[model samples]
Target: MSKRTAILQTAAANTDAATEALDLALAMASMDQSVQLILASEAVNCISDNPSKRYAMLELLEAEPILVFTDEPLSNPHQLDIEIISSQQLAPQLNSYNEVLQFS
Candidate 1:
């Protein structure tokens, strides 16, 4: 009865795709599932401090726990309340989840 799921987003160039992925994750969370979103690579840029192009996705992330990979520097690191972790930490953490969705 494990409802653990991981949503991995790595495409920073497409905001639409990132928003769609966040919406899907929100839907799952609404169903009482434990969901975690991982923003890595260019995808970390999907979050911004200001209410700009990625505002919608940023809003959704506030509802859930998000992990941002620190391999690269983010455009606005102070914008979102994200857990910054390294690539080495990502694999072990991901393995703990029962399911994973990649939106890249």
Candidate 2:
């Protein structure tokens, strides 16, 4: 079995890096590779603010998305299943993945 992957999206959703991260996750998921996304810092904006575009992108994908936040309640118009975690929990969580792709 292929190693599970955790993609770290640290850039704001408007940037190319964020888009690339999502693309990579989608591609990997389509190939049957286990994939997950880690949204840290500004990357959480992808779903927390003006989420329509981001929600559309995620609608067809099968990867689990995780959000790492500190002192900010998360809200979204979309119903995507998201795993929320604290910033302090990020280190150990990321360490649990066998592979990590970062778009920071």
Candidate 3:
């Protein structure tokens, strides 16, 4: 059987929501699921200079693939070491995935 791929889109505006989104993604990844996390719009703010949040996300990145859409430039001072894909690439990327989950 083919591995199931999942894309998790997050537009969380606050820390709590962002944390919850991260938790969900972690859970999915822990189950040996192919999970991709996309940070868009305000969701990019979740990876600010804050150590705890950044570290949490870094842990998740170690477990699964994390991506950011180029259309939404990150507003945070801290940069996340993840792949940045263009809007044009979004459709094709999603096409390769079996499921897409959005958390706003």
Candidate 4:
């Protein structure tokens, strides 16, 4: 199984970056790689979006590549994981992944 890690940090004001991160996450899912999406700082706004980009993010997560979104530290969920986490938690979480990508 391939492991992918992405940290999405787009505050409410940075919708463009946030949307781009979501798109990237979706693409990663299409590649069939397990993904962990970390939303930190103002990027938490990405999570709060109505309908939650969480669902759209999962659409790309379907099948062989599992996708999860979290801002916090926790076990990986099968479908998708959304959490409120810290930078400290992100470091260790990312270290476990085969590849790590960051989006500001």
Choose the strongest candidate by TM-score.
2
Question: In candidate 4, where is summed lDDT lowest over 10 consecutive residues?
Answer: 63-72
RMSD of 4: 5.4
Work out the TM-score per prediction.
0.74, 0.85, 0.70, 0.60
Query: Per-residue lDDT for 27-95 in model 1, tens only?
Result: 776666778778877777666434234334444544455788877655664465567789889899889
Candidate 1 regions exceeding 4 Å error are 49-64, 72-79
Candidate 2 lDDT by residue in tens digits, 1-104: 66999989899988999889888877887787788878888888777777535435444666565554545888866766677888788888888889988999
Stretches > 4 Å off in candidate 4:
11-14, 49-60, 63-81, 86-88
**Reference-based lDDT, each prediction:** 0.71, 0.76, 0.62, 0.53
Q: Tens-digit lDDT track for model 3 on 1-47?
A: 65655545455545566666677777766776666677766665555
lDDT of 4 at 90: 58
Better of 1 and 4 by TM-score: 1
Better of 3 and 4 by lDDT: 3
Collision pairs in model 3: none
> Distance (Å) between predicted and true CA of 40, model 1?
0.7
Could you arrange the candidates by TM-score from highest to lowest? 2, 1, 3, 4
Candidate 4 per-residue C-alpha lDDT over 20-69 given as tens digits, one digit per residue, 9 for 90 to 100? 66666667677875655556666554434443545445644662222223
